[model samples]
Target: MKTKILTMTIYKKLTTKIHFFKMKIGINNNNAGIIIFLSVFFVSFNTALSVTKDSITYVKPNEYHGLLLNDTSNSIEKYEIQRLNYSTLYDILNTRNELFGMSLGLNGHYNNFLSYGAIDNNIELGINGRSLTNYYNGKYNLENYSPEFFERIEILKGSDAAVLSGHPNNTFLNFQEIIYNTKIPFTRLWYAQEGGSFISADAIFSQNFSKGWNFTFGFKKMDDRLAFDNMSTDYWNLRFILRYNIDSTSSLSISDNFTNNKTITSGGSDPEQSLNMYNPINSSPYYGKIQMRNFRHDLNVTYSKKMNFFNITNTTYLTSDINERALPRFDESDTLGNTSNTETQIGNRINLDFTFDNIEFKAGSNINTFNSEGTNFFTEYSGVNWNLYSRAELKFTKSTSISGGINYGDDSKNGFIGFGERLEHRLNENSSIYLDHSFISKNGLIYSNDLENEKTNLFIAGLNLETIKIEGYYRIVNSPIFNRLVNEFYTEQYNISDYQAFGGSASYREQVLTDLFDKNDKIDLRLQTRINVIVGNDELKNYYPLFTFNAGLNYMLMINKSELNIGFKAGLLDSKTAPRFIPISNSYITTTNNVGIQTTGLNIYSIMKLGNAFVKIEWENLLNANYYNVAYYPERGQIVKLSVVWSFFD
Candidate 1:
């Protein structure tokens, strides 16, 4: 596959740059104990992946479900779920970067990232589980993250789409999926620098002091400085969970979650056409900051009973909050565009699970009410929206299964309808084939009712193959989010009552060698292609085709006493679409169609151990390709970064 080719390139570069060096550090008994403890904790966390379908069947299989599923990768705690994980980041680098208009591309300014999907442990969580943001909006971008704190990043693809609402495609959720059964808390401090610099800290603490009581707490903080002038952020997240087990048959739990962010704009100026345009203050260089806050609390109760040949689990939960954003007005360009927003969401969830001899059953429902509105601190907007989601699953046999579900919701702006089904057949231990189908309808979206409900149908099929040294997948999907309008450039088109998209991707992986330190050394390959055949009445006639091929390989070798991890990644992309940022009102309204491959990206990185610290050097986008990203039309040129990770605890 493509990823393998990329890996080959990485290996060649690594071998050429570094010669074998000998250095030795003594490992005492204390170091052995620590390594053992960390290893056990990591293995336990991985057990979540092998929990046997008989225990829980709702989870979609494979890494496409999220980063948590890359079973073939040597990194025990890090799995690249398709395109969702950081490991995949290297895969993308090894391939070509393509542009498909704004709707589909390697890098666009908008939020199509939100459209992908989530995995287990990640859940359908949004800002307070009320409102969801697009990846381009800085919503889902991983930004700067430490690979150590994460057990896995899961990416659910195709069939898993049934578990989501208010968004399209599968879901992507961070596992943070640490081993909860462990007695001790784990803390990790990580730092990384790309076009910017970032520092992060994460801690997951859990305890079971008695037979029936347990406590768990999670905390995370991330601070990153973007390359763009004044573009930097500080983000914080915390969650507390308490549980009471009633004699192993039932449980009650209460949880609280909080997230806050502060943003500073430094180097770049506001867009020339924005409200800030032509402001007298624009003459001077400046910097400004914005702050956003969100909080959520939930209470849940669960009951399980086993009798005769059947087992059942019932869970109920209450949630509150939706989506809102706020920012302070300060510097020059324009204080008028300064904004503030506050919103609340209240809702309930009920889920059920049933198991029998050859089949398992599951069902769930969700209802949320959003009281949301925001202001530029100038104009006031207020309204409410109602949202709902339901699901059901059925297992036919150990090797084959099918599941289906529907979701419906409404907000002041739009009405939603979604339907989907999945079919899976395991051919053997190493191979399987699967199919997925989905449909969705939307009306009165984005504060417009003149728009009609848009309807879409999606079909997907894929095969998975595994071997002693290699495992991977190949799949494709055909579906559209909204259909086309009868007339082009019609006023109705501007209204955007509905839209549609249909496309698919194919990927693969293989292990080139093993026994580095006599441990497994590896390579990965991937190829993906997607297209949006968009047909909306009026002027919006967008047909976007995007193709990406990526490959990468990393080898770890212990020469003397120090360890060295070297890798290189590269890729190529072909994009066939317009720029992503033209306002909906002006999309296709202009005759100038910006179409091309857009740009490409490449990165080569090496990690070398020098005594107590590790040095990392990376050359990103080595060619310094000229590219235009979707939002705000930011220019992305080549960047070089260097950083270090020190073992302070050890």
Candidate 2:
């Protein structure tokens, strides 16, 4: 699942019960056969494991009408894109709960994610509701798109996702982009082979030429070769969408997300010139000559209206970020220092909602206009960022509720604010429970001038059930924000002060072997389990790793129209001290100088189908262990992949 071609991703809430945009599981169309459930989204052969969203259309989990509702607290952790076995998007958001380590590799779109207490970039991303928060160096190419361009993935935690519009953050990673509302005319073709010399591909085309209009087109590509040693990578993506649903609540859209990146890095490696710290030594004396390039364009326009009372969404974007660096010159190592940088942005975002009965209201705003230029010894900056927010929710009964929020901004200096409170209960009918407290303030534009905002203090509790879930958290961050490293190349934005962390997570899923006996018209099974625990002090606990877990097993076999799928995922992350990547400011630091990581990872995949096409064969780490999240950048040992997706219907 890798091409976010022409890239443009949005929505992804496979099955969550919370509200506040972050749109992830919203297209259920209810009728029209939904093109036979979206042809399994790109893998065809459906024995059904997804594509069912009827509980009340779109918004789920706590069931609609945002105003701080989290269906009894699980702060959101949605990630389902059926039958997939990792390939980007931080591999299904790394180690799950609390997001633990992994960056500087796997295409380096960077995400050591653990925004619980401000860590460079502080996490913020969304689709549909706009805002992909890259604010330069916060990284968000989601590692060159895939997972078939998204259909699910939400990770909202803390600061209650700040009502999501970006800018205010503690983590809120959202997505949903598999633009469908087709009226036939579908087309899909894909290819992949990743074990060595890696290569991947995808091509898509969607429909609806008239009557309301809907169109989509996509293309994605990738080529890689690297495990360390000179390094290399190449990528491409192109996506397009045009929609006009002006009826049924209203809609209008236009999108384009383009990508092009080429790399040959040696930004790391030098664990004392490697003599086997599990093999590491890039020492870059100029080994690869350093070439890092990136080109991007995200042009968007959106409008939405749905009313009985109120609902409005507005998004306007124009972004272009270009970077080019060709090194080999710090004193002339043969003279070569080519630099090119261009950054442009024009953004606007808005979301408003209202409900009266038990009370609920939401409001949001975001504005941006930034510019940068370089080439000729680079250095040109510009800014203008704005934001506003509000939230409220009350319910005296019907299972209780309470919420509050406030946010204010002014990235051009002198203004920042954030606060929150929550309490909810619903302990029955499939469970619910929550408790929260927050105080956050984060300002942007690569900060550090006057330096004052980058604070966080969150405390949370959780419980949710239908198949079990649990959460617990405690956090404290005073200055936070860091990216220091001012002399081994370049890096800035520092704020360091107080830091503390706490954690908890529990999970369970069902359908294990279905009915347990008999009733086998070919079979289907499911099982999932999770656990995560964390504790921190000494500033960020070395970027987290106190015990992170995973377990999964899903199988399906329905041989007739052709079907078979088997997937299993296993995990464990214990030892820590992983952070030290900066490669000309890609970011990740936690100095005290050291490197170590304990690993136990596994991934297996299989999906087979014939007529309409489907084939996915995977194996990542599958026993060939040995891991690391930074420092010489290890991880990536046993790899195997093969994909083939086909579809074409008129």
Full-model lDDT for every candidate: 0.40, 0.61
Error of 1 at 204 (Å): 4.5
lDDT measured at residue 274 in model 1 versus the true structure, 0 to 100: 40
The per-candidate count of clashes, in order, stands at 77, 25
Per TM-score, the best of the predicted structures is 1
How well is each residue in 1-650 modelled by candidate 1, as lDDT tens digits?
A: 44345445534543232211101111112222232233233324323322332221121111211121212222333423212212212222222111122321211111133232110011122321222322111133232222333345333444444344334334423332222332332222222334434433344455554555556665555555444444455655566656555543444555555555444433133343344311323322122433333343333443444444433433344443333333335555645544444444445444444456654454445454544353432123334444455545556777787877676666556667667788878788777777777665654224232555545555666666673222122212222222222232111232332333344444555555667356534444434444334444222343343444555566666656576777766655455433333211112222223445744566677777765456666777777654433423344345554444433222
lDDT, candidate 2, 14-90, per-residue tens = 11211211122122222212222232254332112123422312211111212122232333232243345445557
Off by over 4 Å in 1: 1-160, 163-179, 194-197, 203-218, 243-253, 264-335, 374-397, 408-415, 444-447, 467-502, 513-545, 558-564, 576-595, 607-617, 628-650
Q: What is the Cα-based lDDT of residue 217 in candidate 1?
A: 66
The C-alpha stretches of model 2 lying farther than 4 A from their native spots are 1-102, 108-110, 113-126, 129-141, 144-160, 164-202, 215-223, 227-273, 276-304, 307-309, 312-455, 458-591, 594-629, 634-650
**All candidates: CA RMSD (Å):** 12.1, 25.2
Deviation in Å, model 1, residue 253 alpha carbon: 4.5
